[model samples]
Target: MKSILKVKNLTMNFGGLRALHNLNISINKKEIAALIGPNGAGKTTFFNCITGIYKPSNGDILISPKGNNEKINGLKPNIITKKGLARTFQNIRLFTSMTALENIMVGCHCVTKAGVIGAILNNKSTKAEERLIIEKSYFILKELGLEIYVNELVTSLPYGAQKRLEIARALATEPFLLLLDEPAAGLNPQETNELDELILKIREQNDISILLIEHDMKLVMSLSDNIHVVDYGKKIGEGTPKEIRNNPAVIKAYLGEEVV
Candidate 1:
């Protein structure tokens, strides 16, 4: 398959209640996909399953490995992330006490192979890695327009910048796939526009595939190459944005228009 993410017959449960039922989805390499749905529609639960926060009781979640097929469903979250998957949270989760650069440095820990002994002893190998890691952190910070904020404590940055920093930290993980959960949550129109542009830039420039969970209809419709609509924990429709916009089932799920 040409799909980077292939979720087949996936199911999730919380005791007796079902969250996702035989969910089948595929995201191709470098494709931007959006998952939009009403509140409590299992969107977050679905994300949880995909990213390894919860293991499915059955089925497989396969991610094309840097270019090979890898079954990633059973792995732990960190392990999955190490295998080139990274995600940002709906809630900002930066370390407020650490400088923005420091937070990013912490994220590079996943890719760091040097043991703590090597890290602490200024071992030659570790020292060389340190230089490389710090350089990468700086490059990512500059790319996200947070170079000036690099030395500043994360808590001191403005809300929008903080959001961007969170994203940068995720990027520093150096993953092929990025899961962005409500990136435009608190942004004003200007910041939202900038974010839209940044996301497009990331896609076009970096060849990054994004799976987004966003409530902002404008952002979702404008940014997505394909769209999935879910309601009451079930997918009512999936199609291109224009197709989704005209889907009566989806429209009635969000905006009640009497079906003819």
Candidate 2:
């Protein structure tokens, strides 16, 4: 299968501080890849670059849907999203006042071509879009086991439920690839398990590729088909979960030297 997303020699710098350095990553079509590292590692920086929140100072980011060799590095976030890339942040970013269903309906706005006037007038120019959006959003809510809370105010839901709602919002965008930053961050064991299952189901049902940056090693190892490790702005290792588990470099980076 073709590569859905590609990053080569990616670097992000803030003044003299380099957050990501010469990072190279590639995710194939319909695959799930994880980025893992120590707390100060450049995983989040790498994510920002890919999602267009940070423009790479040097390197290339390519997406296949728009054809190869197209430079996507410096594109704006919304532009990149329009090109079929979508993401959820490390923190839940919901409209607190909106209901769970409304949060998802907002995501559907990007893919729908209805202009502000069309929406205001409720014109036929957008009726079909609105109908499809409602059906798809409801379907996504059901897929995430969030149907029961669809009408509840987002702020009133549990923390984990709020996070899952964020995922539902991203899926509503109809993205070809999804980037998840620590979706399991604040969840309990049961909630984590549900998130893990839902993530896999997303790949299976939507055929969407995923790039996840997560601190939970168990969750990362279980959900990722491949893993990349970073340390202080640079990639130190990349391999299967088993390989990463046994790598001395990875252990030392995360835990320092173990006294024998």
Candidate 3:
């Protein structure tokens, strides 16, 4: 299988404190990969590094959206999104005042071509682009089963629906590789189960690869084709779910602990 994202010798530093040390991870095309570690394990740091939120102190972040390798470390976050890498945050970040449909339309800004002048003039071309964005945003909402909340204010939605809306916004970016940060963070079991099915459906229908950071072991093991474990910013274990479940190091560090 072709690789979609590669982090080689990745490291991060905050002052003299090292957060990540030579960490390496890879996600293949159409694969569902999980990065699981305890809190303060530097998992979010890795996502920030790869998604251009923070430039890595040392190492490379390469993405192959079209089968051609390109280094993305140090690029702006928006540029990275445009490069077919879109991500949701560990915390739900949505426009509280905006409607669900409008929030998703904001995500389309990266892919849209209308400029300030175009918006001011509302020319034929700009109007057409605006219409297309609305149609596409609605389609994404339907895909995520959020069409019912289309005109509702984001803050009016339930917690689970808000979480799904975040993913919907990311999908509106038209990414080839989707990075989900703690997607199951606050979901109830039923919602998490729904999210599990939603994620698999996303991969199958969108033809995209996924790399997620989640603490939900059941979801991780069930959805992931491969799992990478990190502790103290270093990779301590990596394998299939079965291998990871049996790995001594992982058991000592993560799996052994009470999930909640």
Candidate 4:
């Protein structure tokens, strides 16, 4: 399988501190991969580097979109998104005051070709594009089971629905790779189960590869085709779920807690 994302010797530095060190990881096309580690293990830092939130101090960040490989090291976040990589923050970053549909439309902005003149003149092309955005946004919401909150304010939706809305907004970008940061955080047992189903459905239905940073052991073990364990900014283990479960280093570093 061709890897959609590849990171080689990736490192991040914060002044004198090293946040990540000589890290290497990859996500194959349509594969669901998980990045698991203790808190502050630089999981989110790795995501930021891949998504262009921060430029890595060293190494290459390459992405293969539709088998066309390119280096995205210094590209801006929007440029990376346009290159078929989109992500949701660990924290919910939705526009609370905006309607759910409107929030999703924001993601569509990257793909939309409308200019200031097109918007001001309200031409036929602009109108058509507007309609297309609405249709696509609604479709994403429906797929995520967020159709009921389409017209509601983002802040007014239930917590789980709000989390799904964040994902829906990312989906509106039509990414080949989706990066989720702690997506199951703050959810109840039922909500976590639903989220697990939703994630599997996203992979099956959209045919998009997913790379997530999650601490939920059950969800990670069940949903991930492969797991990469990191500790103190370095990878300790990488393998199938069964191998990861039995790996002593992974157990001593992370899974030793409540993970089984």
Off by over 4 Å in 2: none
* Residue 105 accuracy (lDDT) in model 2: 93
Candidate 1 lDDT, 1-260, residue by residue in tens: 26899888888889998888877778888888999888888888888888889988777998885667789897899998888888888889999889999999888989988897996898889999999889999988998899999799999999999999988898888888888988999999999999999998878766789999999999999999989888866779999999999999998998876655
lDDT of candidate model 3 versus the reference: 0.94
Sorting all predicted structures by lDDT, with the top scorer first, yields 3, 4, 2, 1
| Runs off by more than 4 Å, candidate 1 | 257-260
| Global lDDT scores for all candidate models | 0.88, 0.88, 0.94, 0.93
For model 3, what is the error of residue 155's alpha carbon versus the real structure, in angstroms, after optimal superposition?
Answer: 0.8
lDDT by residue for model 2 over 65-131, one digit each (tens)? 6446567889999888888888898877899999999999999888888888988999875897899
Q: How close is each model in CA RMSD to the real structure?
A: 1.6, 1.4, 2.0, 1.7
lDDT of 4: 0.93
Better of 1 and 3 by lDDT: 3
Residue 145 error for model 4, in Å? 0.9
Error of 3 at 27 (Å): 0.8
Q: TM-scores across all candidates?
A: 0.95, 0.95, 0.97, 0.97
Clashing residue pairs in candidate 2 (N, C-alpha, C atoms within 3 angstroms): none
Q: In model 4, which runs have C-alpha deviations exceeding 4 angstroms?
A: 255-260
71 Cα displacement, candidate 2 (Å): 1.8
